[model samples]
Each structure stands twice: as structure tokens, then as C-alpha cells.
Target: MGKKKTKTSSTETSRTVTTPTRPDWVDAQAKGLNDALTDLGRADPAASVAPLSDLERRASETAGGLGVGGGWGSGWGSGGTDWANWGRATPATGPAPAATAPDLSGARLEGRGEVPQAASVLDNLSAYMTPFRDQVLAAAMGDYDAEAGRRRAAQDLEMAGQGAFGGSGAALTRSLTEGELARGRNSRLAGLLDQMFAQGASLSAGDADRRQQASTAAAQLGQAREIEQAQLTQARDIERARLAHEGGLEAARLAQAAEAGRMQDALARAQLGQEGELARQRLGLDGAASRRADAETQARIGAQVRAAEQARLSASEQALARRIEMFSGLPLGLFQGSVTDSQGQRNGTETTSGATLGEIAQLVNSLTGSPLSRLFQKKGQA
Candidate 1:
């Protein structure tokens, strides 16, 4: 099999290859210095330092003097800023004196001052100025007697140089070993500083990766929460709809029950109406019976009136039959042999069957048309 070729992103390639980037410690240190300088610029515009190339000659001269001075905080002496080789402090033991008056006898005064021509002044003057000249001459030749003072001055100068080279902390060390380590790139300290600076840069990369991962995780969590909330809201809405449907069903069931109850009531009322109709029919039947009874009573009274009229007519006819037989000289029997006249006389056996129809008609009219029949008619009305 052939060796497989793989591809990688540009960012990974650069990291593995150790491409040039600012060291974290160095970058941090520079950022801090720039910030300080910016603050200084705000406070004092005129006094602000420019880049070395941009500096004026006067400022450059000032930097050189301060940086290379051999006294005070400088390398040649021990004191604050005021210490100098010739001007500020001269030792009392070696070459410095409190009072040394000038000579006037052998020297002539220039301009307007009068001369002092006294031998006594000249004799005492040697005692005062002799030390002064010797001190000046000895200093000029570098003949300092105190080895401690010379050593201190050299140490001070060396310390000040270290401050200038190592940069702005203005480091001044008491030990030669510390100064030596600070001055050059040496074995142990160099290795230690390199490892610390590399770790600092690596720590920055780790922190950046951690921050990116946290952002991605937060986004995912937010999406999950939105989905869960939507599902919950949908479930709640469904439950509400189901409850409303159940309520509607319950209402319908109640309405049906009420309608069935009404139907039952109507059935009961119809049965009662039938019972009432039957009762009315019974009453009508009783009233019809009463009317029939009334009619029967009236009929009976009519029949009795008819019989009484018949009896009255029959009795009157009977009396008439007896009188008719006597007048005809015949017996009142149904048949007789007689010859009869107006009076009661007989000649021979004869049958007088001939009666006057006119007379009988008259008699029946008188009886049938009597006040008694009229009274019966009035009873019929009642």
C-alpha cells in the first residue's frame, strides 16, 4: 500500500510548526509599560518621552548624563542624587576642608580693592591654603587614601549601569552574584525564565479553547430548553380542549334526560284527559236516562186520561141504551120482538134495528169534545 496523504487546517499546522508569535510574558510586560506611558502622557504633555530617534539633542544629553553619572545613585559614590565626584561632597579626611582663607600679601588685587602689605597675614596664610592646594592636587591625580571609599564608588557605578541595561525597575543589588546573573543570559535562570514564559503562552491558548467550548455548550442548552417548553405548552392546550369536549357531552346528556322527563309528564296528562272524557260520557248517559224517564211518565199520564175519557163515554152510552129500549117498547136486551111508538106500546113482534145516526153522532161529539179531554191536554203540557 502507498503512504496516504492527509490534510489539516492552517491553524493546526502553524501551532505544531512553532511559528513566530509574541512571547506571552514579553507581550504582557510591554502592554503594561505602554499603559503607564499613556497615563504619563495624559499627566504631562510637554515632559513626555519620544522614541529614541525622535529625541532632541538636549533630551538625549540629559539621558546620557543621568544614565552615566558616577555619583549618588550612580556607580562612583554612595548617596542620593546630589552626590558627585568634584562638586557636591568631598570627604573631610582626604582633601576637603571647612575654612581656608585666600592669600593677599604676595598677590596683587585687580580692579578697585586696595593692597594688604602685611608679613603676619602671609605667614599664617601658608598654614590655611597649603592643605587646600595639596587636596586639589591630590584629587586631580586620583590619589584617594581610603580604599573603602574607592571600592564603594566603583560598586555604585556598576549598580547604576545594571539599572540602565536591565530596564526600568532600576535594579540595584547588594551582591556581585545577583548583579552578574542580572547582567547576562546565564544557565539556570535563563532556562527557568524560558520555561515560565512558554507555559504562560500555552496557558493563554488553553483559556481561549475553553471559552469557545463553553459558548457552543450554552447555545445547545438554549435550543433544548425551547423544544421542551413548546412540547409542554402543546400538551396543556390539548388537555384544555379535551376538558371542553367532555363538558359539552355532559350538557347534551343532561338535555336528553330532561326531554325524556317531559315526555313522561305529557303521557301522564294524556291518560288523565282520557279518564275525564269517559266521565263526561257517563254523565251524558245518566242525563239521557232521566229524559227517557220523563217521556215515559208523560206517556203514562196520557194513557190514563184516554182511559178515563173512554169510561165516561161508555157509562153515558149505557144509560142511553136503557132509555132507548124503553121508549121503543122493547127490552134493553140485544134483541126483542116488538112494535113500538113514542110511548111504551107494542103491537106485534118486530125488530127496530134502525137507529138515528145523526143523533148518535151528536151524542159522541158532545162527549169527545168535553172539558175533561181539554184537562188531559193541559196535563200533557205539564
Candidate 2:
């Protein structure tokens, strides 16, 4: 049989494992160092190269056949793992899901690209107790030592500090003069700041005086306004009292005027009533005059009756006298008898003087038979 062959490292053989990257602390630390070196290159490019080259060499030594990746690899979460099974539980009620079988097969055959990431090698190796002798391994001592790479990287970083100050002797002299000018400018700025502070103090004092005066004026104005308000209230009260008094006086005057008017109307009514009574008294006087006239007419009628009786008596006396003359050759005894008869007739007429109109006419007819007829006939003719 041939001798067993050892697996040569990436330094010796260029072959790399092409699988998903796993957690490897040594390789992560090397990469971190290289990335820091690249960042330094932006500031000073020449200073970064030496440290970067040594990092690459040490990375190859430690992580020889481990192919690395670009992104940060987090672990497979439970939520994504659950989705990878896909619709298995949903289809169990009926027939099995078609997607369920396919998803399961896919997960097994075409493996998901995921891995657990490790921390940096610096975090991993920091636990080791340190000494210069144990830190840098000699070339003959160990097959895997990043000691030489670490030393070269340190030397190159020292070189970078000097590299930041690159160009020459004449520039240094001008830089010194620039420093002096910068100091002179700072002194002038300090003087200006002092002057500004003094001006600010003066401004503050002026503002304080103005504020005090404004405060006093505001207080005085407030007091004056209060006085004016008090006076206005007093005036309003006085006006109200005056209006009330005037209203009472006006009401009294109206009442007195109304009473006077009533009194005048009553007097007029009384006078009118007295005039009506006077007119009634005049009417009563006319009635009295009519009664007197009636009484006078009655008295006149009585007088006419007496005259008629007297005339009848005289007619009887004349009749007796005529009879006596016819017996004139005779005696005094017949004359005496005639006188006695006439006297008797006169007493009878007197007794019948208050007789009614018909009775008086009847008496007159009996006494002067043809005489009253002739008289009535004669009056009618006349």
C-alpha cells in the first residue's frame, strides 16, 4: 500500500470547501482586523497596506479550507421553520394538500442556506493568560502560529503614525509661523469677547431702568382707571335717584290735575241741574196762573147769575106795579099785597143763586115765560 497522504492546508493547496459557512471564531477575528485596516486606508492608504497583507496571511493560516461568506448569518428562527412545513395541518380535514408534500421534500433535498454565527476570535482568544514569550510562537515550535503576523502588523501601525506627516522641512517652518498668527488671532478674539460682555452689561442696566419705569406707569394707570370707574358708578346712582324723584313729582302733578278736572265737571253738572229746576218752577207758575184764571171765570159766572136774579125781581116788581095802575081807582090794600109778593120772589131767587146751568135756565123760564124767549130771539138776530 502507498503511504497515507496528509490534507494540505489552503497555503499548500488552493482547494476550498464549498458548503454553507459555519461558526469559526479564528476566521471571524482575522476578517475583523482586515476590515479595520481597510477603513484606515481612506485616511492614509500607504499606512494600511502592510497591516492588511499580514492579516490576510494569518487568516489563511488559521482558517485554511473554510470558505467564508459576506453577510451576517443569524440562526433559523421558529417562525420561518414553521412556514417551511406549509399547509400540512389545513389539508388534513379533507384529502392531503399537494403543496404540503412538495414543501417537505424541498426542505429535505434543497437544504435552506442558514447557519449559526460565532463571535470574533478576539473575543474567543481574550481568555488566554498572556506573556511575550508564549504569545509569539517560534517558527520551529508550532505548525499554526499567527505570532509573526501579529508582530509585522504592530510594526506597520507604528509606521502609519509617521506616514500621516508626509511632506517636508520648509513646510514645517511655515507651519510654525501659522501657529503664531493663530495665537495672535485668539488674543484679538478674547479682547472682542470682553468688549461684548461689557456692552451686554450696559444694555442689561438700561433694560432694568426701562422695566422699572414701565412697571410704575402701569400701576399708576391701573389706579386712575379704578378711580374713574368709581366716579362713573356714583354718577349713575345719582342719575337714577334724580329720575325716581322726578317720576314721583310728575305722577303727583298728574293726579292733582285729574282731581281738579273732576271737581270742575261736578260743578258744571250741579249748575245744569239748578237751571233744569228753574225751568220746572216756571212751568209750575204757568199752571198756577191757569188755576187762578179758572177761579176768576167761576166768580164772574156767579156775578152774572146774581144779575139775572135781580133783573127777574125787577121785572116782577114792574108787573105788580102795572096791575096796581090798572086798579088805580081802587085801594092801598092791593099795593101792599104786590110789594109783599115781590119781596117773596126776591128771597126765592137768592136761595136758588148756586143752582146748576139747567136749573137756573128752568127757573128763569118759569119766572119770565115769554120774556126769556124774546130775549134769546133778539140776541140771535143781533
Candidate 3:
């Protein structure tokens, strides 16, 4: 058989096989260090520092975002949050429509195109006087004929008497005288006829003129009646036109009043709606304010808690570092034993353990008090 090969290995390792009995002093020191380490773990400095950086970054982002918004200084409000705008009244309805214009076409009046013509009064009067003038002329002619016949008979009788009484010279002279007398009588009768004819003609003309004047008056009366009738007709037409115009105006007024009333009603309703909306908006703003206040208070409380945790962590870390420094000076490897390797028939083992009184005292002092405290006030001091 080949020579048996032998290999050996030794390593330092901590293993718990069973619960160990510890001295009172050692237990106290161990408990102090464990408590300090546990506190350090619970209040890690990173917990405070990391959150602070995150908070600062978030605040910066919020402020920057607000600044970049378009409103600028004019848009700022009480808090960082944006404020709501006030409710506005509903836009006014378009202007009230114009009232319907009155229809006055029928109410307007127009004058007649042609004036009325009346018959000629002078022409009518002349026709009426003509018959009376002719009757007067005939009566004058008949009287002249009767006077001429009587004058001729008287002259004949005088001429016969002169002839019977005269055969001598004296009788001839008397005959000549009688002839002269007859001529004179004839001339006188002709003159009398002429005078009668002239008187008749003058009377006839006077009668004709008087009759013509009466006829003219009658015609004037008829024309006056026609004028009165025309005036009455015109008055009636004017009155009708006035009544129609008044009716149209009244209708327009009624329409205007109705439109005004409608507009007022609409305005009232709109105002009422606006008031209700404003109330709702105000209530919302108040609720937002309450929520904001609660959030700010919570933030302050959280910040205080974090600050306390950071302080505790700093104290705990310092205590843990002091404990490490104190234990490093102890000489636990001074108690030593050898290790053996087992090949076929041999087994190997190694062990080490030790403690120094000075190390124990240093640890005890570190736990109960500081090194400076032990040096300055050791046993008694005045």
C-alpha cells in the first residue's frame, strides 16, 4: 500500500453551540452596545438626507412650473395653488327688437285732382229777362198805332170844313191856313209816338235788369249749397283719417310695452341663476382652503418627526463607533491550543481563548462613563 497522505486545515470562525453564562459586568456592557447599534439602525442618516433632497427637488419643480406658466405676477394668488375666477352674469340677450311700425297707408288723405265747376249765373239771368223785354216792346208799338190813326181822322175832317166854306179869295186864304194847321197836327202826333216809344224802351230795359239781378241771386244761392256739401264731405274724410292714425299708434305702444316686459323677466331670471352659481363657487373655494391648511399642518409635523429621527441616528452612530473602538483593544487570542490533522489513525483540533483585566475595565468605563470623566473625578474631589 502507498504511504498514507496527510492534509490539515485551520480556520477562525464564531459558532454558537449553546447559551453561555456571562458575568454581570459583561452583560451590562454588551446590552449597552446592542442597544446603541439597534438605535442606529432604526434612525439611519440616509432616511433624513434622502427625503430632504427629494422634498427640495419637488418644491423646486412646483415653483418652476408655476413660474413658467403664462400669467406672470398679475396671475398670482393667496396660495401657490391657482384661484378660481368669479362667476359672471349670463351675457345680456340681444337688444330688444324694434316694435312693429304702425301701418298708416290707409290713414293718409289725398286731395281731389279736379276742382268742381258751377254753372254761369250771368248767362242764366240774361235768358230769363229776354221774354219780359219782348212783351214791353209789343205794348209800346200798339199804342203808337192807335194814336196815329186818331190824328189822321181829325185832320181829314178839318180839311173838308175849310173847302165847304170858301169860294172867294178869303176862302182860298183860309184853305191855305187850314192846310198848314193839318201839317202841324201831323208833325205833333209823330213826335208824341216817338216819345211814347222811347219811354216804353226805357221801362222795358229797367224791368229786364231787375229780373236778371234776381235770377243771379238765385244762382248764387245754389252755388253756396254746393260749396257747403263739399266742405262737409272733406270734414268727414279728415275725421276718419285722424281716427285711423290714432288706432295705429295705440297698437304700436301696446307692442312696445309687451316687449319691454319680456326683456325684464329674462334679466331677472338670469340674475337669479348667476347668484346661485356664485354661491356654489364660494363653497368650493372654502373647502379647498380647509384641505390646504390640513396638508400644511401635516407637512410640518412630518418635518419635525424626521428632524428628531436624524438627531437620534447621529447619537446612535457615535455610540456604536465608540463601542467598536473599545472592544478592538481586548486580547482574546492569548489563550491558545494546537490543531491536529487525522490521516488514518490520527485526528487534529485547534482552540484559542483569553481575556485581559485592563480590557475589561476599559470596556466597563466606556459603558458607564466617558474616559475624561474617570480621569478628572476618580475617587474623591472637593
Top lDDT hit: 3
Model 3: how far residue 125 lies from native, Å: 16
Per-residue lDDT for 178-235 in model 3, tens only?
6765676566656655655556556656666766677677666666666766776666
lDDT of 2 by residue, 108-197 (tens): 122222222332323322233122124432222332224434544554565456673345643574466456645655665455545545
On the 0 to 100 scale, the lDDT of residue 302 in model 2 is: 34
In candidate 2, residue 309 scores what lDDT? 39
Residue 60 local lDDT, model 1:
36
Q: What does each candidate score in C-alpha RMSD?
A: 86.1, 86.8, 70.2
- Looking at model 3, the pairs that clash are 339-349, 340-348, 340-349, 342-346
What are the Cα lDDT values of the candidates? 0.42, 0.41, 0.48
lDDT by residue for model 1 over 1-382, one digit each (tens)?
Answer: 2244444333211122333444455455546556654664566443332222211232333334432323221221223333122222322112111111112122221232223222232334344444544564345333333443566567668767766545434343445535553443244335544554455445555555665566566656666666666665666556546645654454455345444533543444444444554543443343344334333433333343334344433443355456444545733233323332332332343333444777655665577658875665577799
Error of 1 at 235 (Å): 2.0
TM-score of each candidate structure, all chains considered together: 0.21, 0.23, 0.25
Model 2: how far residue 183 lies from native, Å: 3.3
For model 1, the local distance difference test gives 0.42
